[model samples]
Target: MYELKTKENDRSVVEFIENVESPTKREDAYKLLDIFTETTGYQAKMWGPSIIGFGSYHYKYPTGHEGDAPLVGFSPRKAKISLYFATGDTKREELLENFGKHTTGKACVYINKLADVDVAVLKRLIEQSVRFLQDTYPNNNTN
Candidate 1:
């Protein structure tokens, strides 16, 4: 059995944002908190030590691996902010075209700052990602 290291915890989201080394990043983190909260309509929750996540969903693979993950989240890292979304969603790729400046990784979108991206596009990405995950996993594990 494989264990998920980044399970959700009761840590303080505000405290985590307050401890960010860069003042700019700290401010951006607060902004992101507000964006994700208003867009997702879910209160922010700390995932693992760094990720500020909104709503959560449980996913089980055909190989029998199962875990709970946030519908959308972000982390204000040192180099760039990492945005988490559903993997393998074609809609995400399409939206990124008009998302302003950002780079895509295996499962995240990295951006230097909120200003470099269009907030409207970001909200759409959040909505689409959450919808895709809910439709794909249709289980009762969503919150």
Candidate 2:
């Protein structure tokens, strides 16, 4: 089980964004971080080394393998941005259609830039993903 940290050092996350070499990327990351914070209403957090996470949730499956995972999060990678959608693959195709040009793994959505996507749709997707995860697992760990 992944131990969930109640508090995070927001400064570290901001510092990581500030240190990005590309000026444009850095500025845009800050802007999106603002949007993410406003949209999710969950304080931003640094998950692991790079992922800037929003709220968090706890999961336990039939096998008893469970852990604390962020409700929604994203990372500004060198090649592209990665959004974590902790939900199923049922609505994956539908969301991709309107989410603009992007790629997807089992649960991660990749976008080259914010300019290529709709902020509203992205926010909705994150909101939906968080809700789904919350509903799927009654024992949510947001503290």
Candidate 3:
């Protein structure tokens, strides 16, 4: 279950990313957090234990079940960094093509090392993805 933190245990996303042991990964996470939030104009919030998410959107299924979820986010994983730009196949390969070097698993883009990817291109991808999400879900962009 997602543990929603209150003012008592409030933690900033920057602090959470910095807590990671890896210097390179931590820096990358921090930089990406700034870049994503700035470009996407979305607020950053530390979700659950490790995810630093931006924006919020609700999904409605055919079965009438609906739920709210972060529109975009990333996590500093132990093995690699995971970038989240919503879910499913959003035909983001074009952006990925220009996203320098990285591996992907479904909706999450994984980078084994920060040196393997181009940071500028990654920023573009984030901006584009967030814009696309906001366009698709008019109510999600809270910037």
Q: For candidate 2, lDDT tens digit of each residue in 1-143?
A: 55545334455888889877777677778877888888888888888777888888777779976677788888888888888886574665677689998998877898888898988888778777777787887767584
Clashing pairs in 3: none
lDDT minimum window of 10 residues, candidate 2: 1-10
Q: What TM-score goes with each of the models?
A: 0.96, 0.86, 0.81
Clash tally for model 3: 0
lDDT of 1 by residue, 43-62 (tens): 99999999999889888889
After TM-score superposition, what is the CA distance of residue 31 in candidate 1 from its true location, in Å?
0.7
**How does candidate 1 score on lDDT?**
0.91
Candidate 2 TM-score versus the reference: 0.86
Check candidate 2 and list the clashing pairs. none
lDDT of the candidates, in the order given: 0.91, 0.78, 0.73
- By TM-score: ranked, best first: 1, 2, 3
Taking the tens digit of each residue's C-alpha lDDT, what string does model 3 give over 12-83? Answer: 876787688998888888787788788767778866777888776665668866556677778888998998
Give the poorly placed runs of model 2, Cα more than 4 Å off: 1-11
Worst 10 residues of 1 by lDDT: 134-143
Off by over 4 Å in 3: 1-10, 87-91
Alpha-carbon RMSD, each predicted model: 0.9, 2.8, 3.5
